[model samples]
Target: MKKKVQILSILFLGISQVAFSQIKEEKLILDRKREPEVKKIEKKKTSVTAEKNYPPKEKKTQDSLNLKYNITDVPAASDFKTSTIQGEDISPKFNADYQNNYFQLGMGNFGKILADGNISTTLENQIEVGADLHFLSTNGLKKEYNWDSSQSSANIGAYLNAFGEKGKFNINADFGLNDYNYYGIYALTPAADIDLQQKTNRFKVNGYYDFYSNNILNDVRLKSSILTDKFDAKEAQAELLVNLSKHGVEIPMDEVTMNADLGINLETINSEFSLLNDNTSNYFNATLSPKLTFFKGKSYLMVGSGFSFLNGKNNSNLLTEEAKNNKTYWFPKAEVQIAAADEFKFYGGVDGGLKLNSYANLLEENPYLVSDQELRPTETKYKFYFGIRGDVDQSIKYDVSAGFAKMNDILFFKANSLFNNDFSLNRSPYNFANTFSAAYDNGTVSEVKGSIQYFPLANLVLDGELSFAKYNLDNNENIYNKPLVVASLGGKYSLLGKKLNLGAKAIFSTDKTTNSFSFTEAGTTPNVYLETEDKNDKIGGFADLNLSAEYKVHKNFSIFALGNNLLNTNYQTFKGYKVLGAQFLGGVKISF
Candidate 1:
């Protein structure tokens, strides 16, 4: 087995060299040119102005010669990435500036053995490890409509990735494993409170181990995500992609050629949380997407469909974990998407997919914060929306698309302790979620791309949603959460030749409720939970503004600054939860 593995590895390495041989040759040519440039610079001499005072007695002008330093040209990083880490959530993330592209090679999941690119392979050997430390707080006053989540610690483990060659063959291995304990409580004040805690560990290993013989790519490579939780959330995905295109990946200007790939991905998620951890649920999702191109132009279309089978039985133990508490979803789905024109031009596609619960909650944390958690439910939805996409026209421009959706039970946090709740057999109706979104991107740099979204109605929202789906549960059937406005506004702008990045996001809505001026028979003071009918006030949404900038001051050094909650708007996206007023952070990085 060892011998075979070694042989196979060598084979793969060899093939990769052949595939990207063009790059090697280009490097050689570049080296030649680089040498000439250096020689030219060396031959150049620096001019100095005549200065008086070389000798106090002489007081005669003399030419002063200054030393000239040589500037060596370094190649740009191989790809468009900049940071590496313990897990997706752990930071020192890449500089917010999108233009700061330097590749750090490592391993885990994504393109290489490790999704995050860094070159330290020794530390990523076995049990992956990660760390996240964040501190946040606010003034003591717990005001209604205040949005806040206190200090927190989160991280993960397991990361691996390796690519390049295996003897005349191209092999890529990308995989990662992550585990984190997360807890945060945000209040919408007077009426709604969101206290959430989760412990999850996930693993995904994917890669296309290819061996190129006579330019034929072949091999058995697998991609998958494996998850294990404190409760009973288990998920696994496996995909196989076989490239059937003849060498060259493709020849430019030769539009009539098409390279085909046959791929099948199978996924499974299981849970047990009945009376005695007895609610057992299982689902299998399979998909096949293929790419087809026509004419020698820059256009391509990828089409595929996904099918799944799901079954679950809820018992008392199911309630122990909020996600396991609800057994809802369908197995199977239709998938469609098209990427045409070019890698940077027009593209459109859609797929009914599954998004993990943990992943979605991270986005829900703070309207302005970005999270990397992805362990929620097997997001099952019949999805279809298409539009043109590409950086062409200098912006991501796409046509409008609309589609119907059939959603099963979705999971969101409510004020309940999964550790002590009886969820094995009880759940609000299949959580209802309907969504529509549209936006416009300005074709100008340092300009903004804005979007507005809205949710018409909801079946169960305690007080209703505030920005970004901060739901208020009225009763227990209120167990489900809804998108605050189902609508919102957001945009991003690039500044300073793409060195500075700025983004603004906000969502708002209001509704009157029984919550009215119920005074202590005297109506002198207002109650925390007091409500007034027809008295409309913004229910949910946050107007979040975040700004970040990165400037390359030197070849190997860059400066960065991040400002969050820029306006420090006193409004709250979460009820009773008061957000930290304003935050400022500045840091510098040294990487070549």
Candidate 2:
């Protein structure tokens, strides 16, 4: 039994040793495979985790600037122009800024109607058909020695406008035609003087307002334009206005602000005979001014001062042509107002237009320039003014003003021996009879203008106005003198659900002083040359009556009818200039 047990034990021991060796082998293999896989996993990690492992996120910030652009569309036709009495012909007209179609047949105040009434045809870029006609038979003046004349004239005009954008750029243009005429010059001229008449045909155009800025951006603005007046001259102008607000902030209310402006005006006259052989002037006007004003809450004040420079030439055609005058002028100005107290306030301002007319000739060194040294032109004026205003109600207001001024070296023409048979019938140098002097007698003038408004009812408005002016030569003779007075009263009524408006007006003016002297003066006579006076001018008075109505047919369409000198009363607003008689015009307007 001992022998058998010892053999079995030896066998069991051997088996146990083998089992232990196998277990150790399996563990070694497992460790070898797992270690390499774990190492690979640990080595291949994300950059995000690496960064997170290093530090917490740190906040970052920065300041930056930005730029932007803007554009717009507008034309030169949007401005106010001259007044009129009546028309002898019929034709639609445009704004004076784009074209001037004076009526030889006689057209009245086309500009005033465009501004106050509903007439889109007055804009250059419109399509319209209209008629303007007038006839006036003035009763011979009550005086024994009288000025009597009769006139019959008529006119017709039409226009068309095509619309388009300025492309990626902001630009626009307008084209149109106007015709007019005048008569009764037989009386305007006597056997003692030359008789003159005029017929006008005007073609017009204005294009491109290349660049501008948005309202809030007071930074940079560049503008360019070209204008031509057939009866006058051609002009090219460039203007730049820069607002300083871009460099800083904290704009205060009604406080002073600073800015800069640059303007360049170049003109080419039609002929040398039209002026003193020197009508075209090149102007470079620049200013750096501090403005103090605020219309907010009904109060405002503006004051500033800067230097001015003007250079004029005798002839503009020659490039090498030098200017005869290089004038430098400097002054300070102030404007003030008070309207915060609702109904009662005072507003007034004065600017000193101090300039030396013949400072130094710019073309003095250039031989190509045609200049007359004897004209001996010069000028200086002191302008002073004051005014008070009060608002009676939402639609009612009253204003009063006073002004006085004296001018030296005023411009006028002295009769040269060249004109003996100078008659209105002659066109050029022959019957034109004239030697022109740029310097005239010194003079003094005083003027007053004021108006009142009352809206007694919501649908009715009444207005009244008064004006007075007097002028006298400051020379040794003191024989040349002038005085003028004008008064007007009118009312307008709303009708047809306020879609239509009707108005009637009456006015009186001194004909002898107003119309009689409006002509160019030559050789101490009336209506011959510029800076001169016409012949045999006397004082007189005249009256006028006017009526008008406007109706709106749709949002973008309307019609208007107006009549002036409605009473057919004999009158004159300018001394030598013939007054238009009774006239009527009616037209339709379409707008976008």
Candidate 3:
């Protein structure tokens, strides 16, 4: 029994030893597998250790091998430094600057003086105010006239503009003073001892309103003027004009634009002539015009009519019978335009109107006029015209037209040889046959005219016009002081980066005819006279050339020069008055 027990014990001892060895190997394998996982957890914990404050971790050890492991905490990183990027500042540049004010002064031969200035400013509330002054004077051409032929003119004006949301209003007032001397004489002799100095004063006020409210009411204008001359010739005029229009209305078909327009004009003129024993002439005119236009594909047709009512009273003995009539005028205003091609067009029209002739208007046409003159209204009975217009190219355009007109009471300027027929030096003033008087005649006129414009470059422009006319007068032998042929050519060019500008113009006019009357004392009476002969005096044609130049020293400063009548021809602008041979003016301009 003892021996059996010993064998079992030996077997148990061997089995126990084998089991312990197997367990030890398994523990080593488990530790190797957990090492990687433990390292990963330690790295994750170390990353967050700087952000959080944690208590110390417990140490771990293997029982049989007595192995230990430890983990260390990490330190926080230093604060990072931040900065911003910076760049250089830049400003805008421009080639030129705009100015709102200008001033100019000049002097030339013939004792000429000129001055012009303007100032404008914009205040708050869309309001603008401006003022301007202009003056020109000449001390006379002593060589041409034995007496003083000096002339002077001065003007001062102010304007105000108020802009609204949908409209604008403008008001302007101006005053003018003109001093002139009439030194015209007949070819045979000089006579009359009249007051040579004539002074004229003018004052005017103009008001305009333009609407942009997208309605039928378009614009309105009111103008008034007062004029007084040295001879006690006074005139007062007032005019009112109103325009109404509506566009984009379909009349006959779709996509066709129809426009309706109406215009009304009212004017009154009053005059008093001291030379005619305070003879007073008063006139009032009212005109109403209405038009309708239809536009379709670059072609348009307009049909309209005008009605005019005229009433006047004249107590002047010179205009007694003709001025005592009241008349009503009917005018036709019609036009048709057809586009034949992209570049060509055909047009026809008929128009007529009444032209008011006043003392002020006659003075403007011929300054050396007698104060006691006949005043009448010109009636354009009918004017019919047909024309062809086209564009030659993108840079050129042309227009040609032919027209025929019948007119009544057309005014003509004729020499008034009041006291010069006998060459009397001690006669009344303004009797040297140098002054002009109004002559009326019924006439028919036929004319052909053409115009062309060329714009080859942005800074260059050229234009030309030519016209020929034939006049047949009923009561006059020939058309007085009217040109049969007229032509003009003009051009402007800029060079040197737009710093230099040059311009030129040429004008040519055909000869004019003026009637010369001779009287012979036939009766035995002291003042009785009989007309002997009436002859036509011919005034030769003339050509005028003008040149101008301007050089910009700076953007705000410039020097200019003008050469007028460059041909130096001694030409007569009127029947007896001759213009200066050549004129030169140089000056500098400044702007701010």
Candidate 4:
């Protein structure tokens, strides 16, 4: 029993040892698994401490990001105050000064006088109102010259504007009185006592409405006007125009736009003299244009087309076959633009339209026109042009172009032929009347033109333009009154903070040809009669120079002097009428 007990104890001891070894192995495995967790805790604590010392970057505001230079070192302001930031003031500067009223008066050689006044102010409801008056008179160079003229005009206008909105309404009214004499006959009959006086009174009213929205009907406009003039002749015209447009029509890589215009015009004219005829005219026009623009690259092309319908009628005794009927036309519109570089661009286009000539319109362009005249519309079939226009530098710009145009029924002016009859009551060979009659010439005209503008200094600017034209008439008729070459140069300089301003302008024109009429005796002694003969008269070219200077005496007052025709040129814009010579005028301008 003692031997068995010893053996049992040994076995029990072996079993105990094996169990202890297994238990130890399990604990070792658990410790290996927990080692990574202890290292992670230590790393997390180190990360937290580092983050507390140095915070992460915060997102920047839009305003701060837009700044070109760094301003992170700037100190926070303790109190609100006006101060400079980087040599620029960050405060609002308000000026409550208003100067919208002015008056000027002056007199010069040849009994010339000028008076002008203007006043403008802002009213309630965002309304702006203004009025202006002007008066001018000149006794001319000499009594024998018969070039006396005088004019007076006034205008009143108002505008109602919606700020931060999309609408506007405006209206204006004008009245004018002009007086002049028929002095162009002096060259034909030097000693003729010509006392023909001409006077004209004009009245006009114009108004317009514009609105914009965000629908298919994006924009709309309505314009209307009434014009009337009375002289030896009476004329009246009324016009109305309506326009509608749409925008923001998106296409692939482009935007498309469309516009439509409808218009109506009516004119009536009458003459008191029995020689001139009376007439009434009406015109209706409508057009639709669609345009496309691409905005994907440096080069772009705009394609558009205009479909127009024109209807016209005239009730008169002297109406031409074309003018007395209705017509329809089509106009093409297109343009191309390419940006070659940062400061260089190339552009070109083709466009055409119809233009109406009325009695009131003719008189405004040439006041010496005869009352007995025929009116018509000019139709431009096509006008093609190509050019380059861009800035050479920050201080200079240039535009050069070449073009060709085809026109139908273009008008030219020529002196009236002398009547040759002794027994005829209206037969005065030298009637002491110089009348310009309109003549039509169907033709094509080609032209080249260029202009340049330079700013050598901030306060000084110089500009010039030159043009050349060639006309090919279908009927071989002379292109009367049209200059082949024309050029102009002008400059303005300001000194002493614009307290003193100086300006100079010069114009040059090439000679042109016109037809002149003269009377000659014909037949034998017993049967003596007068015959009219035609001669070509060459109007000489001329250069006109004008200068002006103004000095400010006060903030609201200025003294100025002007010199016109400084070269004393004996040039005649008309066939026989000579312009004024050298003259000086001084005046004071007051602003309030």
Candidate maximizing TM-score: 3
Q: Candidate 3, residues 52-94: lDDT per residue as tens digits? A: 2111121111111111111111111111000000000000001
- Residue lDDT tens for model 4, 1-592: 3353354345434533443443222321222211111111110010111112122221122112111111111211111111101001111101112234777787777666767666766677656677656666666546445333323333333333332244445566666666666566642443434354566676766666544342333334343334443334555555555443333334544432222222233323332322445555666555555555443234456666666666666555665553545566777877776768534667788987777676667765566676656666777788899877655544556677889999988877777754333423232222433668767778999999887665445445556778999888898556877788987665555566667766655666888777765544465543333545344578877666656677889988888777665666666666766666776778888878
- Provide the global lDDT of candidate 3 against the true structure: 0.66
Question: Which prediction has more favorable TM-score, 1 or 2?
Answer: 2
Which runs of model 4 end up more than 4 angstroms from their true locations?
Answer: 1-99, 143-164, 190-193, 212-232, 248-250, 254-274, 278-280, 295-299, 318-323, 419-433, 522-535
**Estimated TM-score for each candidate:** 0.45, 0.52, 0.79, 0.74
lDDT of each: 0.31, 0.38, 0.66, 0.54
Worst 10 residues of 4 by lDDT: 84-93
- Model 3: how far residue 466 lies from native, Å: 1.6
Candidate 2 lDDT, tens digit per residue, 257-341? 3222222222221222232333554444454444433333345555655455555455433336655767666555666666645
Badly placed stretches (over 4 Å) of model 2 are: 1-172, 175-284, 294-301, 315-323, 353-382, 406-444, 476-483, 514-536, 550-561, 573-577, 584-592
RMSD of each: 20.7, 33.7, 37.5, 30.6
Q: TM-score of model 4 relative to the true fold?
A: 0.74
Q: Please identify which of the two predictions, 2 or 4, would achieve the higher lDDT against the true structure.
A: 4
List of clashing residue pairs for candidate 4: none
* lDDT of candidate 1 over 493-518, digit per residue (tens): 33344344333332233321111121
Choose 2 or 3, whichever is better by lDDT: 3
Which scores higher on lDDT, 3 or 4? 3
Superposed Cα RMSD, model 1: 20.7
Candidate 1, run of 10 with poorest lDDT? 61-70
